[model samples]
Target: MRYEEELIDEVREKNDIVDVISSYVSLKKRGSNYVGLCPFHNEKTPSFSVSRDKQMYYCFGCGQGGNVYTFLMEYNRLSFVEALQELAKRAGVELPEREQTAEEKQQADARLTLRDMNKEAAVYFHYLLKSKRGTQALVYLKDRGLSDEMINQFGLGYADIYRDDLYQYLKAKGFSDYQMKESSLVNIDTVKGNYDKFFNRVIFPIMDINQRVIGFGGRVMGEGEPKYLNSRETILFDKGRNLYGLNYAKRSRSKSLILCEGYMDVISLHQAGFTNAVAPLGTAFTPNQAMLLKRYTNEVILSFDSDGAGVKAALRALPILRENGLRGRVLSMKPYKDPDELIKAEGQEGYQKRIEEAESGRMFELLVLYGQYNQQDPESRTEFIHEIAKKLAQIEEPLERQTYLASAANRFMIRKNDLENLVNRYGLGYQYEKVNEQYKTPPETEERRQEKKKSNKNQPQRLLLTWLVEHPEMYQYIRAYIGADDFIEPLYHSVAIMLFEQLDNEEKINPAAILSRFTDAEEQKEIAAIFNTHLKYGLSSEDEDKALSDVVRKVKLASIEDEMVHTSDIVRWQELLSLKNKMQKFSISRS
Candidate 1:
């Protein structure tokens, strides 16, 4: 069962929407509402609005709107239950323990089972690392400069040579085969049955932000073709969405994050007291991971290996970090392969110094480009200058772009105007429009464009829905005349049906309450757009009545016209014409 309605009401009352949103966004008072740039999307203008009286927020640019719960769910990517728990904590509301419904219970059990299985596997592997079976692995870790305390803190463990040791242990512990497979800890063979996914390797448990063990990574102790093996994508784990050691890194309270290339680099950095270090899980950095990092720190330092592949990876990550509004810097690890080797040779202080001396992303890219060609060669210099111009053009700030342009001119001994022109030609600063000479709006083509223009045409329907929700007493009168079938747009249709049903059930027509009925983010956005749209002209009681009558007539006329197009028989066409005539007469009478 869900939380008690009284408790939900109390939570909502205590946690005002403006107060909650103000913590994440810098909202400024604009009339009765607060306005800020949208956190969901990158924008310069303040299109996100929060209403103190209505207890809701809406982004006109992105169309994301809802109450505090919707904001938490979208901004933090949390589930409804998770958002509720978070709000309950903030509101200081004591939640009564209740029994879960069968479906909820099953889902909770599945997640708990996976977490418990991973925890047990971590423990079992840790024991093996300390046992005689893990002697060589322990020696290997020691050679890599890992102390016993550091190993224990990181939950480092070893999987023995036996293929099904973990499999047998988990099975004996009463874990179901399905749970094990779902956890991605065991692989099921068609003929061989189930076997451990990690063997003859040292295991590193990957955890969620809450520090719950979700998956594992294993590095082979001895020589192997594939030296590192990570958990496959499963219900509990997505490799691209997770970063290794983030659970610990976030607690460092550091102003910046050190994004390394591998598990060892992150672990080594943490062991060296630079706890704010995280690495992607066996894949290149992703936009999701970049956005996640933006939540923890304002700056990110890329500390990949000093190899060609690592430089390329860093280059790719630069734009992603910029897109997510995080400052990215590059740590030059030349004369050393990675952080692990650098820390091993020069200690923590040396690594810290290197971090301090790290260059900005643009500077790093320029340096890398400079190394590719000799300046004495005229053709190579031209190509290099153009490449630098393209990179400089991507910088949005005028002052920043000017600074880079000046630097480039000084370095290449070229006129800054030539480079600026090249940047405008190749970079995002360039604006080009193509004219289509054969563009024509046929019936089918117009229908295709209807989705874009539906917002304008359906304004009356949206206003009617909004008015019905704002004045539930009017729902009875509106319901007698119109139904959800009158709404042409699916989004508005869904909202109308929900509003009618909610009114019939005597439920409050609140944004939060209405939002709870929807699970899709897109649907929530549309609902927010409907709620945020303000009527151009004021609707007094008399005006509201006329507006409702006019909208109903318009809807009926549209319905008739739509039916007339589909009607094949003479009788159906005549009936549609009669309905249209009656709607027009009713509209005239109401006016």
Candidate 2:
């Protein structure tokens, strides 16, 4: 019913899945299917397959498969609607306007309002920083040794100490008080009911990956209890997810990512030509942030404040980096309180030397340092060892664990044997392995598990689908014997059913025809990923068909077993009653 759905269907109807994917992959026609290397994961052999009659794709190596929409979602990392719109544009399908629900309309309106407010706030603060009102802030930055270029690159700004200044500015610009409050740009007094949270402070805009200003952090210029104020959580941003200067860092280099503790540190470092640097926005490093870093580079350098708190944060972050498969090192600078000061006091050269000379301390050493600094004694040591052991256990490599065990033993002055034994006692490795195994089956408790399972189970069927789309002539031999209903898994079954019904109804097969019928955005993406996986790795046709048949049979048997279990529960009582009645009849007849 939607425009993208219709457009996708048209594209699928006109184009052959194999031919479309062939543009991306080098495919060879092997009887009924095509085979290629899988694009999802790094593999040498060709396990990806496409079926001309099925209009689907499957990657046997990685078990990735779906339709054209799924292909785009995985390859391009585009959302469902975005992928649909893109594919539609490619296929020359004109789409109609979509109807928005009431909730959708409201959310859209709120987002627009928040975006406008953030832009206005950013502009106002930047203007203040340049004007006479911001003389103190300018002097503050100058004293901190930040260059004009650095300030501009970071879009640093200032907010005056006037009550309701931001409120008034936004109000005149047509933003309501409610919008300002919701935007987190200004705060309302719980007691007085109206106030600005960021008065008399230098403001720093928090940006997302797309460089959209999502939130702000304000440093109090004068003597204040807190000294810093950050924007509350909003729709566009979470303090944990948005890293400072990552948008800039990701663009410059891909070799190494520098994780700093503060925005000023990142800005100053970037100005010093250390461009690959970013910091979490007013929060500790999170797993999401760690995963984000992994995408850009496996090598990471953690540079926190030289204070105890900074060291502790680095220690906490070590296991996270390790867990995410990041090659990370901790840089312990002079106890100069903060990174901005050290960089300012000692020029880039000095900081660079310190960074290079930094000792590569394992996570356990950092934790020991943390414990020592915090003065955690006897009882705390017990809790501490358990914590550190758990963190160490997350390291999946046996060699890596042994390496860290030595480090832990040396730092704690305990025997290497005792420490190694303690680390093993925690069972962190076993827990991680269990979790890893659970992940292989697509997590049963996950809300989307059914879809994930179907995707996983129907990889071979997807290959057939892709081949059918690319080589429709192959459909004749398989059409009568196979239909969508034959597939046990929904993804394969659904695609099969769609193809069978379409060809049966229309008396012809077209890969692009039913794309529009895939209205679910998530499913569309799954299909795109599936297709992209196959196309990225070209495969031969015959092998694809054989793989599909084998998987289909396995899935059907599993489905039958599942049904038998369910039916057995229902018939259990009837069997018991029948046996009892037979015994009674036998006894009565004998008497």
lDDT of 1 by residue, 1-591 (tens): 678766776777789999887666667798989987677765545678998766788987667888888888776656667687899999888788877778667767887788789899999999999999999999999998888888998899999999999999999999977778788889877799778999999899898898888788899977895888999876578776689999999999789999999888888898899999999999878766876787788899999999999999999898777756689999989899999889878888899999999999988899899999888999998899888887787676889988988887787677978887888777654322111211323355665678668666877778777776666777666565567777867777777787778788887776666665676777777887778777545756677677767877877677677778877999889977977887786632222
Candidate 2 structure quality by residue, lDDT tens digits, 90-180? 7777667887666657766887788778988999999999999999999999887889988887889999989788888888999877777
Task: Report the CA-based lDDT of candidate 1 relative to the real structure.
Answer: 0.81
Cα miss at 133, model 1 (Å)?
2.0
Clash-forming residue pairs, model 1: none
- Cand. 2 Cα-lDDT: 0.69
lDDT of each: 0.81, 0.69
After superposing candidate 2, which stretches have Cα over 4 Å from the reference? 4-113, 187-194, 359-394, 402-591
TM-score (C-alpha, index-matched) for candidate 1: 0.74
Clash count of each predicted structure: 0, 56
Best by TM-score: 1
Output the worst ten-in-a-row residue range by lDDT, candidate 1: 431-440
